[model samples]
Target chain A: MHFEYQVDGGNFSNAGVASSQFKKILKQLNVDPGLIKRIVVALYEAEVNIVAHAYRGIIKIDVNIDKVRIALIDEGPGIPDISKAMEAGFSTASPKVREMGFGAGMGLQNIRNNVDQLDIESVVGKGTKVEFEVNLG
Target chain B: MLVSELKEKLNLKVFGGNSGLNREITGGYTSDLLSDVMGFADQGKLWITLQTHRNVMAIASLKDLSAILLVKGQQPDADMLELAEEEGIAVLGSDENSFEVSGKVFNSLMQKS
Candidate 1:
């Protein structure tokens, strides 16, 4: 099964809707419980990143018998330093974003922590695409 | 502590998913940030926080949490309540802040176990 969701930027309240829906799909497919948890966490962290940093984006999920894959593509100024961005305590969120109990710089790290494989591609001024994968077997 | 007893101790108003709640109370973690809560909270503990967003349900679902308490009398939005209902997560509302609620829950859990 495949799913796509448009993530509205800077909207803390509506964030994670995509991940939540994706989780349901995974459960219905009878995916492994541990894999489902990892997929949900990775998807959610990426969704929060799109909401926090990008102007707008799309979160996509592709599921099959063997693995579940997630892609977050955002049309925002790309990450200048992928290393810093992946750091657990590194965050560039504005004060407004922080007030909502997010923007603690854990999004990328959280995604990396939960997923089996993670890949990030970015251009300085063009955009960023984050891909995370979970092996179902 | 039974989920029913924690409800009374914190004077919580069961706002959603009353029937789906687990009777077990393994422990609790209090955090307003959904990210921290998602990373740290165990599968059976009551999650105490003032954050009443859909992501709260998302995290609770991911963690397999027993229930959620919205502290400081904060009420979840209509959409959040509906989502909680669908997800089978008990959403509780309380007049206390996260710290006080955590303290009370910690003491209760210690006493029970």
Candidate 2:
């Protein structure tokens, strides 16, 4: 199954909409509970990253019988240093975002921790593309 | 323990989501960071935090949390309460701080175990 969701940046209230919708599909497909939990964590974190930092984003989820692939591609101020951004407690988010208990710099690291394979690519002035996959097998 | 049981024991105020009052509480996690809770909170846990936004309800619903107890007498935003009701995850409030209420919830869960 293939699903795509659009994310509006700086819209805190709608941050998790994509993840929630995908979760319901996963549940109906009888995806493993543990696997669903990990996907939910990674998806929500990535979803919020776009909402907090991007102009907008497109989330694509492809669930196969053997694996699930997700791609979050966003248009925003891209990361200058992906490695530094992955470090705990390093962030470029505004105080307003911080006040919401987000932008604590744990987003990418948390995403890395939850997915089986992950990739991130960015252009300094353009945006970021985060892709990851989980083996359902 | 059920959410309603904890509410009575701790004398918490129900902001909304009454339908989830009977949800089972397996334990509790206290954190203000959204990602921290998203990464660490287990299913059926009661989240104790001071962050009162609509996303808090999003997390609670996504995490399969039993309830959320707001700290420091904090009231949830209007959207937060509405989402809580829709998600059927009880949103409880407390005048106490996170530390105080976390300890209380800890004891309550421990007693049950």
- What candidate 2 gets wrong by more than 4 Å, as runs, is none
Worst 10 residues of 1 chain A by lDDT: A12-21
TM-score (0 to 1) of chain B for each candidate:
0.91, 0.98
Q: Go through the candidates in order and give each one's DockQ.
A: 0.61, 0.88
- TM-score for the first chain of model 2? 0.98
The C-alpha local distance difference test score for the whole of candidate 1 amounts to 0.82
Per-residue lDDT of model 2, residues A9-54, tens digit only: 9888898999999999999999999999999999999999999999
Candidate 2 chain B worst ten-residue window by lDDT: B104-113
Model 1 misses residue B15 by how many Å?
Answer: 4.2
Where is model 2 chain A poorest over a 10-residue stretch in terms of lDDT? A103-112
Residue pairs with backbone atoms closer than 3 Å in model 2 (clashes) = none
lDDT of 2 at A20: 96
